[model samples]
Target chain A: MDISAVNALPYEDFVNIFGNVVEKCPLVSAAVWTRRPFVSLADLEAAINQFIDALPESGKEGILRCHPDLAGRDLHRGALTRESRQEQAGAGLDALRSDEASRVSRLNEEYKRRFGFPFVVCARAHDKASILRELSERCGNERAAERARGIQEVKKICRLRLQDLVRSDNKL
Target chain B: MDISAVNALPYEDFVNIFGNVVEKCPLVSAAVWTRRPFVSLADLEAAINQFIDALPESGKEGILRCHPDLAGRDLHRGALTRESRQEQAGAGLDALRSDEASRVSRLNEEYKRRFGFPFVVCARAHDKASILRELSERCGNERAAERARGIQEVKKICRLRLQDLVRSDNKL
Candidate 1:
């Protein structure tokens, strides 16, 4: 669609298009919806902040739903590029080595026990070691703070994904 | 790892970590890597040119690889998220809509006849219509320019994916 046509879309239509993108990925939806019709990319970002502020309790749950179980297989959806999946899964499994896996298992249990959800992390960017370190560290956060942090992280992932998606489409 | 440990790593290490993230998504890496080793989050962004200059060619290719084919089902090896393969495949098939399909088939045959590889795009971010638009638009470009542009777009994608990965991992 023309950039001008995109500009002409009613707020609801814009929302609808954006909403379609985000709906499959609630974390993305929350992040994108957090920002509406962006006059400039900067404005779009500010909207992300506003959207995060407006998040409902249920929205938090929705964000959590997109995450795969920690160290669990079948976490990803499709044929992830060979290198990306190898890196993420290798890092996750490495973090869970021998006793570490048990510890992670216990932590996963505790995390779910406390927050009523799986421990979610956007695993795309992390290395095997760094991810392991994070898995161990975040296991210590108090429930409320961790939950809030998780939602925020999801929001960040969504924003990045949106930008990536748009840029790809625009080939800009 | 402790924040200090992260800080302690050589800049190359940081680049390596950052490189992995961008391998699948370049545009994000391009936007965010503009900022470096932020002492305070306040001191984050600087300029894009320097950071881009600092990146290796393989790093650039890694970013380019994150995108899905324009009409193919495979996600780039560097792709971080679980893109729906079923969805992408269905969409690819859909793009071959009778008239367009024949044209695409003819183009696919002609293009492959001329070039040794399949046409590629980061399809997850695009809808059928926009992709079709791009396919037709790109058909007119000179072979060398199209290859160059295609490679460049891939790099941008890798950068974006890398940034997204880093942001997610940092929070974890």
Candidate 2:
């Protein structure tokens, strides 16, 4: 749908179109709905990012926790939403061979152990090797730094999902 | 670290060297130590797999949970064991950019949600895209079937790690 159509949509309908960009934080869409008539996709994404960025640490953690581990346990069982499934499928994570899966799992475990949460990133923009490389490298960051980085990653992910949900007047 | 050398090492040393081949389940290394006299890497790997295969469902799950999500948060934070890091690095999961990272996280979430555990696969055997594809496909399997698949994947992972731990008599 276009930006105007998205703005015109009712509360639930607007959320229905966009709420899932953040996995557990469905209310963000409703909040975004209040700031309707976005000038462009950039405007909408920036609003969404601003709202999330302004949240307290606890709130941010909650949003972070809502996401699953990359190629972690959840995907093995077919439990993701349709959008999430398609997102992963686009990057080929859906057909990992045995060893690549293990590498992904190993990094995930170490990252959570250190950071108290999963690493967040925009999967739509990367491939498997680059993800692993980043995962392997990012865990070295200080907790605060990683947390900040994670927020940025979450923004990227949300922005991409938003783009998918709305056919922007101007492309991202 | 040839098999003969691995076989000859003292008990503690043996466990120390091989203890973490299976992610969370460190006991495998100790157990493997007791069943020593490994003539080749294949013999050592076979014994480990056989023991794991014979475990009860709860035991299997316990071992499974010990592993992290593929391309998950831990990798980003540099939390993987050295062996895990190298293995993942070998397969290029260490360098995933944003979009691929998202795909892995989504697949992991879906798989765990359905199977009550992360999707297990041998990382040494596949590239990132293949890993994503397999993860997407495997999540559809029946729970029992998926469990069996996970166990096999675990075995594959362990074997690869073991090879790294023990210099193979003949390269794999």
Candidate 3:
């Protein structure tokens, strides 16, 4: 919908629209209700960014901690969100050969261990091989630097999810 | 100092130790050679974690693009070897008001757009705030999930660097 259309949404309706974008974080969406009728997708994303930026380190960490590992344990258990399921499948993550799958699985564990969080990247852009490569390389990132990268990745997912739910002529 | 006492080495020898860390990337170390042995560092990070996974698409792209985007374009202007300068300037990236730094400076870009690159959880190890938090959340990945994430943010930087790099460690 156009920014004008969004301004017209009722509070609950607006939150409902964006709440889905961040998955479990309805509070972020709810909090953003005060900033209505954004001028562009950038405006909407910016508002979301501001709210997240202002959050306590723990709150932000809470947000970062919200994501799963790439080709992670959650994937095998069928625990992924509907959006996540499609995204992972988009990258051929579900079709991994046994050896490939296990390597990715191991990387996930080692990443989380090294970084104090799961290894993250924008998996949709690459493939099983690239994702695994990133997992290993990023193991070298400083914790603080990696965390910054994590939040950025999550927001990307939200933006894509937002594009799915809303339309825009302005750049996203 | 010979290899045993890496600490005592004159500058030229020190660079030799880590120059081998990334194979075929002589520029990485020949550039780093000016810097000497890092005495305070722990044992060298394992080499296995340095291998790029079999990302046919990205691998092809990697061949095309060649160098990693160290802090993005910053690598090009005599900054690749300036590791010490960057390590000292923490939080500056987090505070970026301009989009350029954020857009080109993402780790995702540095990693995919450089590769080396791997999880399980004890599952019972962390809480929902940390776990489901991890699961549905990491879906925002730009692994190319990062690129997708990055393009969103890059568009953001390019829109503001889309969104500045997310600075956290849950996985992205």
Candidate 4:
């Protein structure tokens, strides 16, 4: 298939393919679609930026839905690989001695009580201490800001994920 | 776990935990570790950039191992969801009439011939036509460059998967 052929696709077909992606992971779809008819890679990136900026305040929760629970040991239909689970949990609970583990447990309880959800961060980029610090700091963020931030973080994660998917397919 | 606790752990433990992640997906671990001791969200992103820049010549091959093989159906431990497979195959070959079906088969064959592997793309992000176009254009790329790009994309995918895992845990 050539770019010309892709460009020639009826908008409905194009939308249908992309719409499924958007529905599954709206942020990623938004990032990709924000740049329509991708003339070049740079243009594609710009569209991604524009999409991120244009996301509605109400849409944040939808974006957040794409992420799985932290320390969620069980596998779901479309969960992360086993390797990913170990990595996030390892980093999340990194250096807890017995006492610190209790404290972390307590904090987890209290934070959940306050926010109505487990603390979420883009764990891939954070170390143990940094994550804890974020946990503490975000505990104080008004619910709205924290939720918005979570959505933003999720979007970043989606972009990264989509990029990886494309790369893997190309290799195949 | 506190930062000190993470630091206090035996180096082997750190390696053991983080090692699984890297082992499952080296590009992802590299993407995460490149940003060690992430103090701020900004720091974490900076590390991701560094990882992208420092990717090795062979990194693409390393990432390819993370993707499941492409078949008329799914077969790997973790690949597309069941629903995704159903959607990808369409109602059946009969639904495609003859020409459309032949075109898909031919494109799949050409893609495999040029890349020495199945035409892989995050089907979620593309329609049949766009995917076909990508297949043709990417076939033109030198193996080395294509391989590098593929690995980079895998890194992105792994990170997104990890995020999903963490979010799911938090929800629980």
The candidate maximizing TM-score is 2
Which of 1 and 3 is the better model by TM-score? 3
Worst 10 residues of 2 chain B by lDDT: B163-172
Model 4's i-RMS, to one decimal, reads 14.2
After superposition, which runs of candidate 4 have C-alpha atoms over 4 Å from their true positions?
A1-27, A30-46, A72-113, A116-118, A155-172, B1-172
Lowest lDDT sum, 10 consecutive residues, model 1 chain B, at B40-49
Candidates 2 and 4 compared by TM-score, better number: 2
Better DockQ candidate (3, 4): 4
| Candidate 3 error regions (>4 Å) | A168-172, B1-172
Give the per-residue lDDT of model 2 (tens digit) for B118-158.
77788888888888899999989998898788888888788
i-RMSD per candidate, Å: 15.3, 18.2, 18.6, 14.2
Per lDDT, the best of the predicted structures is 2
Q: For all the predictions, what are the DockQ values?
A: 0.02, 0.01, 0.01, 0.03
lDDT per residue as tens, model 1, B1-172:
4334434443324433543332232233223432344563222222332333343432222223333344432332333234334435545643366776566667654553453233555555577777677777777777656555665554444445434544565633
Q: Which of the two, 2 or 3, has more TM-score?
A: 2
* Model 3 lDDT per residue over B1-172, tens place: 2323544543223333333233222222222222334332221221111122211232212211322232333333544333212321332332334554554335333343232210111122343234334433433454545323322221111211111111221212
| CA RMSD (A), model 1 | 19.6
Q: Is candidate 1 or candidate 3 better by lDDT?
A: 3
Ranking by TM-score: 2, 3, 4, 1
- Clashes (candidate 4): 19
